[model samples]
Target: MTWKTLIVRVTDSCDGTCYGCLWRKNRISGFTLPVTTINDIVSKMKDFSFDESVILCPNPLYNPKISDIILSLKKVARKIYFFIPVNSLSKVRNKRIMESIDELVIVTTTPEDFKVNEENLKIILSQGFTNIALYVAIGSHTINMDNILSLVNMGKEYGLRIRVGEIPYSTALTLDIKSILAKKGYSVGFTYGMLYGYMASMAFIGNYPVTILAKPLTGECRKLFIDPYGRVSKCPLQTSYLRVDKVTSDILRSLIFSECSIGCRRFELIPKIEISLLTPDGKEIPSEVLSLLEVISHVNSLRAACSIMGFSPSTCVEKIRKVEKEVGIKLLISKKGGKEKGATVLTDEARRILEMYREIRDMVSESLYSEKGIMRFKLG
Candidate 1:
């Protein structure tokens, strides 16, 4: 299945360093991904439709060729997000970078950072970007939630969505303020990995179900996370990643059993079918008949369905006739305006055939992944 979201690592350079770095620990060297690798990712993602946004991770503002990389995916991606950092004196020198970015997520180390970067945050929001988020990274120092409460409100006044990440706040304090803060626009992100047990997840961040959903542990292995060295990791938390050059079906299937999410079965499984029908006389029923039937099944109007698939009314009817002649059965029932402007439906025989084909197509995946596994997940 094609992924709706793609997170590509553009650079490892950051203007400011935070204390509570979960991903960037021990990573000091500044690095940029090769242009060829970037092009390869852009080329591969041409099939998927990214409605959420293409997340350029670590940092993209430091990259000199950020615009060139973004331009390559502009055709396929609807929006581009950058983890652009902001400090007290935050100012983006490149206007193009600021303008091109659809989402600007400023992750803060301490609660005080929210107020400290208020002016810089304004500069970022003024660039016509509506999706501004402030993430709190809990460090060694304990922060008074009172100040954070006010800062979060201030951000909300300017329409900024705030996120608090991985901080072990008092369960009592989070319980006391969870609903109060949520009403004013607050999202707490909790971590659930081998490092931190699930008990911790259910305690502090359990008040918000979104915290569990946001965690990378619920991965589908759909994202291709490429590091500066062209190493590919499905989950951002993974340390053992495959090289970009050696990517193949065998390699991808192997990841279905990765160490992360050893027992969790949250991977999404979507089935798609493309089948051809044959008559006893050896007459072939073309693919366009099923393609048109599939479209008409969802949409009520035959004319609208034809328009959506770039098929003219006459051509669609002609194809339907040809298929009917080969199959020796009427496959569609047409009607005048009903709930929709016009209507069409697959006949009883057509429904039986479609169900049989879909069941067989689903068996293909089961046969492939039933034996192979990524832990408890079947990956045969």
Candidate 2:
């Protein structure tokens, strides 16, 4: 069987925190797949071709050699797509990506950038990116119609497709919002295949909602997730041992025709969640800091948590202490110990803070639907 799409995680090195994502929390420093490994995987796919495309998930910017990776995948894939973050974009990276990629799914926050004015966006779009799309998650709050139109207009101005995503609350995810989205504002017309095909394949392997636990009952899945370590997993979430050391043409082909299904009248859609944290005073705390705090809470050791995020113990100390001062709350209690007796524990206040953070996250996840509608989310 011929595979139409493949999800490749070229690198796990992200420069920023996405707030809702746990993948970037652990591997933020740097790690790129060696060219040899990538080349081997590409050469192995000699027997088949991708009619759709190969999606470079998350951020391709962190991979120094992403342009070359695109070139290699081009031989096997009809097109290439990238998931670009709003804040994480740089001119050089954008230029390189646009040159090599056929389409781009610009992952951005609708509420955050609503009033920011399109000056920067105007300048960036002027640089000329082709076949762009906007991806917004329906988190825990109800989005008003005005903001929804604003997001659609942005995509229209750029002559790009727009996709509004969430874990499916309704069994039949009718394209009701698509009708509103499909109405042209001021751009040329494009087909649904670009947006829907991309959305389906990408969502299939992603982590969100955390509700649906249906693993591929068959030996494989139609799509594959290739990570930076060159491991191939059956699902994008990549849990358990559905991973293989070697990925060949047969391996990828086997995945596409794996005869896998959830064995249900309908499969539950796992909503893609996004969360942002701010102080009661409305000052936004960097998600990276919150992630650090979360790690410390679980491990009960400041140094170990720092190590997990690839940060030095002292650096972590400075970050946490600075937040403590700013928030006027001590998050961690230190224990001076002899040799192995020393440990760090979260204060009661810190535990409360963590619980609150989790509440915000779960709220965003639940924001997948509201009374207004099932298709859009607005975060407060």
Candidate 3:
């Protein structure tokens, strides 16, 4: 399935001031972009096929031009989701803004913002605005359970959907806690699939809340966040760091699928290595070459093997020659000198050994993922 696309308005020229803001530390100077870039982005999105799209302006209030920028996006996007912090929610004219498109995703970083969020929600609801969602950022350093409960209760009372998200670069919540919270009726929005390695959990506490989980949707390509400055990022939280220009929707789609495919392919190739030598009758091969097996396990290529074995190219060739002499079979030296230059290929014997090793590796990996009571997850 095609993944959703997000056009992020990241050109806000913040003066490097906000506390707890990750971007404050790595702020780049002279990074402003022309307004025409937004037009280019809109043109690209129109050509880019996707299931849905969102306009992510982290602090839209800080930039008055955001409304104009979003107005341009409304022309290209059928449904646009907005995520604005609670502090800036009040400054927004709900009536004029809600008419632009589909959903308003209000984000709250602290419990104090809950009251303000509630007040804003009521105003929006009273105005007959229905497509509204709340995003709560649960920080590891200063998150208060009392505040979380209050926000959840408030969301429940108002019949508004709540999505709980963890702070950037945090993995504090355990799966058990996530499962328990999910059972208790809170919608968790994890940033697990973010570009960086940080993992987060998402649980649904209500019937209609948005749930963002770690895994990508089946049959669908993964989503990517493209910043206003023409930088294509994999996630909103990673917008500052992951900047890839000269990006199209197709390249973004490939990037996501390639990541998943590479992981699966690696696992599949593991069974092709020889775990142990076997007799001619297919009996267990002796463990005499176990040290070599260990060495091979760490070797990704001939160069790597040579490095690990503390052998130069010439030494490696001599070692292979010695092994062939002892085993009475031709040993495959991965490197070959040819007119096309040096090339690497596994000999038939080497291939057999590699295949056996891979089989054993696959067995071990399968055992781990399929361990008793391990929970497989799906996200919407």
Find the candidate with the highest TM-score and give its number: 2
User: lDDT of all the models against the reference?
Assistant: 0.51, 0.52, 0.48
> Sort by lDDT, best first: what order?
2, 1, 3
| Residue 299 shift from truth in candidate 3, angstroms | 58
Candidate 3 lDDT by residue in tens digits, 21-127: 44442454334344555666566556655434565534544555556666766665545667666665566674666777566766665666667456756777888
Q: Tens-digit lDDT track for model 1 on 1-380?
A: 32344456677765555555533424646787776766665555555454334444355655677777776656555656556545523645566665676556665664455666777766756766555555554444354466455545665567454554433211211122332333333332122211111111111121212121122234433443566677777544456777766776455434533444332324433222235667778877655566566556655557755543434589799988988876789988876666643468888888886666545533543432233421234233
Please give the ranking of all candidate structures by TM-score, highest first, separated by commas: 2, 3, 1
TM-scores of the models, in the order given: 0.50, 0.52, 0.52
* Candidate 2 overall lDDT versus native: 0.52
Ten-residue region with minimum lDDT total, candidate 2:
204-213
Worst 10 residues of 3 by lDDT: 264-273
